[model samples]
Target: MSNKKQKMDPRVMRTRQLLRDALVELIDERGYEKITVQDITERATLNRATFYLHYSDKLDLLYQSTKEILNDLLNNLNVTFEDKVEFDFSKDADEPHDTFMHLFEQISLNSKLYKVFLTEKDIPYFFSGLKKIIIDFISNGINFTQPDDKKLTVPRELAVRYFAAAFLEVIVWWLENDMPYSPKFMATQLMRITVKGPYLEHPFGK
Candidate 1:
């Protein structure tokens, strides 16, 4: 997908946006468990019939809203990320940095939705969906180095999951801490780990 969102019908988009905004605000005020479909419809100023046309229940509404945000993240990434491409680590950091910069910026834009998704206990389903998306995206995009001269200590799948989980937890930490560092700084830190291993070299080897 392109970085720009596709044109959505104004009326349908407006209705969904109202519903999504209502859900977010209600989650903040009364918490997810306390919220009802009625509360969402009322807050959105739409009737139950209209809400039902778009969603089945409050959980459905919340789930769909979270999904829309995730889709927006993909669009915000601003590159043809789905296609497999060779990632040359020998090159300057700018290549990786640009990708992460777009990512971190998108996360910052949707920080509220992410904060709610990461922190809320009622949305394990949503969280799992989010995790799967990340894992798939990472697995698709990254071309991990493999050579005849080397053997990995762990399986590639394990390593990918580790990276995906760590990436998510880092985002959660940044959001929880109100993003103490700029996106570029965080991207730099992550890039350092990605291009080089996370620790210092032994025996002064490069």
Candidate 2:
């Protein structure tokens, strides 16, 4: 009764990768709403039956593709979190927090796909799913124990939501503007705002 997902066969994995790539290309060229299963299959050089064997519809394909990317982002963050190193925002901007930098790098690497999904494709669920992932990750990483002198004005859940929403907006803006800044710079900016700014300070006073 392990909840882990079973490993997919190599051939199956390749096929799915093809389908996912095909979908992203199609969505980029013709937007998501106009895309049909035939378009994906044709682009993938795959048959309708083969596509159906893996995904029920284009939406399913989109969800699975996005989920895979988000899972990778979460995994990268988790690795840095596991290191148990405290993030020092005062350090040189060239040396941002590892977890944030890694997450931003993942987004930058998949910038094209994210651009299509977040802005061009008209997928509301993408944002919703992304928010949920961010919230879950932050919630798990938060330390519930605080010193006796500090008091929290806002609920822990509210703070998580606030930060997650703000982070999502920043990501959308960055992708929309073609990422004017480097991932390291963007990550550093985010860390500064979240850690050193008044938002966290006013509510979670030390």
Candidate 3:
């Protein structure tokens, strides 16, 4: 963050948080379409100008807060991965499974925010964020591989899109079904299918 954003006062932070909380609550009670900037301000006990200073509109606030949630998720993942002493996936796959479950747990803890993300009104931003993360991961992974043929191939982008789409679909299904399965179990099953490439022909081929 820049100095401008970092230099906010504690009071200002409190007010912003209040507005965000109020907005989520309002959306839960009613719906995003029916909620207005005035409603958020009134619920937060803040002025319209204050709301404007923080956000141009409700969607902007939603995007900003969701980004924060993503950043926190990434930070927690980094912490989990960094603390590991060994990095053997076949032998130490449980760590990744646990990490993924932790991510699900984080999302579950904030079901309201995720409910908004799963909704048609706000799903685009969530998918966009997921796409960006998958793109970066696949890009870096491809960069580390030496091409076998004369031409340079970058099919990892396609692979990333495929994987992210599948992942998002699974998440949306879980959310829509009220997440009957625990995150740990869901992560275990997904990790198996992903790492093992299914039980049949092997997705990546031997």
Candidate 4:
């Protein structure tokens, strides 16, 4: 698939951005369940007709806005973890944001939107798709890193699920706690997990 993202018309982009920002702010103030199309349009200073012109409903608006950011993140990332190394764990946010930084940076930039989506996760595709990205990456990395001669103690599917879910929970925790760390700090931690894992030894003899 072509990685080049199609350019959005500036007017359309601005309208959508207004709607998205309004939705996130309203959601943060109230909650998704209590929000309405009229409420969003009023907050955005756009008419209800404009909202309908752009979206079928409030849910559609939420989906499109979140999807747009997610797609942008995936496109910019283009991360091929093929034989990647971890020599730069101590790197700070001043460095160029490539690879892992792209992921965390996107999250940091859209914290309000994400915090709302993550907490109101029942709306569908809002949170699960985000988790799936992590799952897929961890799966691909494990497959690439494993040696042919050595068998994994845990099933590959189980390993992928555990890591993906744990990583997502970490993200949720970060946002919930007001993101005390920077994007680079979060990215560094993800790299550490990707490389060395938690290293939790078994309480009982294997």
Taken over the whole model, the C-alpha lDDT of each candidate is 0.75, 0.77, 0.67, 0.76
TM-score of 4: 0.81
Pick the winner on lDDT between candidates 2 and 4.
Answer: 2
Worst 10 residues of 1 by lDDT: 141-150
Residues 96-199 of candidate 4: C-alpha lDDT, one tens digit per residue: 22566777887888887888888874556877778877887678667766744258878888888988888788889999999999988888777665555545
Write one digit per residue (lDDT tens) for candidate 2, span 1-206.
01223566778988988998898898888888898999999999999999999999998998888888777766667564446456444564346667778878988988878777887647777777778877875665444222222465677777778888888889999998999999989988887777567453477566
Pairwise TM-score winner, candidates 1 and 3: 1
Q: Which residue pairs in candidate 2 collide?
A: none
| Residue pairs in collision within model 1 | none
- In what order do the candidates fall by lDDT, top score first? 2, 4, 1, 3
Most TM-score-accurate candidate = 4
- Predicted candidate 1, C-alpha RMSD: 3.7
Off by more than 4 A, model 1:
1-7, 47-49, 75-88, 141-153, 198-206
- Reference-based TM-score of each model: 0.78, 0.76, 0.69, 0.81
lDDT of 2 at 49: 100
Alpha-carbon deviation at 101 in model 4, angstroms: 2.1
* Residues 112-153, model 3: lDDT tens digits: 667666564634777677557645543443343323333444
What's each prediction's clash count? 0, 0, 0, 0
